[model samples]
Target: MLQVFVFNIPVESGERIGFSTTLLLAITVYMTIVSNRLPDFSYLDISYLSNFLLSDVTSGILLIICVIQSLRFYHAPVMQQFPKVWVPDLIVGNPYGSNINLAENGRVVQFTNEGEAVWQPANVFEMNCVAQIAYYPFDMQNCTFGFLPWGFGVKDLFFNVVSQELMNIYFSPNGKWEITNTRLYSQIFYGDQLLRLEFTFKRRSRYEIINTVGPIIILGMLQVFVFIIPVESGERIGFSTTLLLAITVYMTIVSDRLPDVSYPDISYLSYFLLSDVTSGVLLIVCVIQSLRFYHAPDSQQFPKWVIYITKVCSKWKQKVSPKDKQHINDEQIVNSDDIHVPTASEEEEREAPPINWPMISGCFDKICICCFTCICMIRTIVLFVMLTM
Candidate 1:
């Protein structure tokens, strides 16, 4: 929706420059431009009683989608004290426009003793605002329209905001976007007087988070479960491969749906690629290595690192409770015990048995499960953090 309301276009009353509405009307006649039809015009002028209004501003973000409503130019009485919104060197890149003419009919209101002449033309404006999609699903974009008064400079004319409202009261809510901020400020661009109307839109990212981010994270967690399957069953490799294939297919299907840039850059693109590849491909490699370790012959001796790992796992698993310890001591000291119990301290002090391939493989599986579970969890946490921040 264009912001349809009264605006103040002030002129320097003390200047000797002639401020005539007739000249303004002439330029208004030549200055017919729409978002598409408005061509690049070089000449400028400020006419008498010129009123610029925006109405029916309809916009949708994600890729900065906008529907051009109407850009109406009206004539009003002499300027009064109106509020001004001053901003520094603010710019909104470049927008596409064409040169078109504005057609107007003179309108006048008559009172009992006084009268005001109102001239306006019915103009239909079509503006197409393409979004900058760098941030994608979690992005805020500025859509701005700058109007310059022809044949005028800062020394000759001043532009100010008449109404404080930047948005139309009738604007409908958009499903993918919401207005976060607005600016109705004026500044000089080049040597001309420019009046700018800007709207900032933030993307509604719930859909992307639920659909795109959720699947990648779920796949990452599922990939780690392959380590739980016993290596002897020979299905660990198959399970990991199947998962990898499924993820590849899923990615291919959703490639078009993921918010990305024309050329590859950061934002969600990096996050998706890093998360999926790390969680998916890395686990597949771990499965292959685990199977190799599992199938090694008994003749093969455990490496020093493997021995250290198994020893760590062994001590961790060998904890005893006080009741169990007392029962074991009693049984070890008596011959007629329900069951003969070995001395726990003696077992701990004995020389370790020769390490075998099966023991190493089993230990390796346990280690992979523990490590990858933590990794997948960390990745998921990081993903959430990036989105929230």
Candidate 2:
């Protein structure tokens, strides 16, 4: 009865355990009452006390066993080969189950059957990293591979910080993949003393393709300007100008997403440098084009500055040709002017000054500049965008 009341059981299961507990409690209580009433209850009373002592010993032994079992379930190793107590079920590429930790840091928690502490292991190396190793149990395709943003380390400044997304991954070459695909959604699990990196993988899909290819296409279109239009034309200027601005805008966005710190990983910092350098090149070309247009020659050769400075003297000394004056003076003049051969001095002034850059190779220079600029722009954008994604 005492066991039943203490344990709060209704005596089901044909009243087996519940009946025994009730009977034991009844006997214990009866003996206690009799021993208290009979001061000299001789051997019978002593025997009753001995029985109670045995019962107490048995209960203590049972309690100890229960505690040990609880500890074992909570902390004992599940698999000898894999010593880790908190290994997730899906790290080896099994489907189903979510250990996706969007936070930058994660924890591996272990609990026994009775909700007891086993042991927690924290780590940044997920199964995905092992997949890149090309070794047994680790060399599996469908792994994580991509560039990390530079600001990832900021979390380590004073406290733990988790990455908002899993941007870094290396996909397997066996099949196609989509950029939007998130094979390992929960990469980290927060813990008291450590962060755990849970490894996960998923099949490639169409979503990833659209997300990845879109940026490539955008960068590619910018490159088309170099090939389709003349470097010196208005079209080239407009296209490059727009592209340069776009690159700058994207760079700013990317930079903001990453951590702000002096030490950035190659993966994140590399993209920033590439975008900046490319934009610089494009802007420089823009300035050069502006100068070229401002100084464009009317007759393929610039006039001497001396002529402009001495305009009054030039007007008086260089009177209009007799034939030109005759035609201008009388609009009805129909007589054809007799041809007059010009002397050496007249011929010298008549012929426009020989085109200045006769040996400059302007065509080659323009084409080279355009080609170089386009290459840099395309390479920078494509590399950074693809890897970052």
**Residue 189 in candidate 1 has what lDDT?**
77
lDDT tens readout by residue for model 2, 259-369 = 354432333333534554465565556445444634566556534542332343334334554335333555555455765768987864675333333212233244445
lDDT against the true structure, per candidate, is 0.57, 0.43
Worst 10 residues of 2 by lDDT: 130-139
Q: Model 1: which ten-residue window has the lowest total lDDT?
A: 62-71
The local lDDT score (0 to 100) that residue 370 gets in candidate 2 is: 63
Error of 2 at 259 (Å): 1.8
Give the CA lDDT, 0 to 100, for residue 2 in model 2.
36
The candidate scoring highest on TM-score is 1
- CA displacement after TM-score superposition, residue 221 of candidate 2 (Å): 4.9
Off by over 4 Å in 2: 1-213, 220-227, 230-233, 264-273, 276-280, 283-287, 290-295, 298-362, 373-389
What's the lDDT for candidate 2?
Answer: 0.43
| Superposed Cα deviation of residue 303, candidate 2 (Å) | 17
On a 0 to 100 scale, what is the lDDT of residue 340 in model 2? 73
Local accuracy of candidate 1 as per-residue lDDT tens digits, 225-253: 78777666778778887777776766665
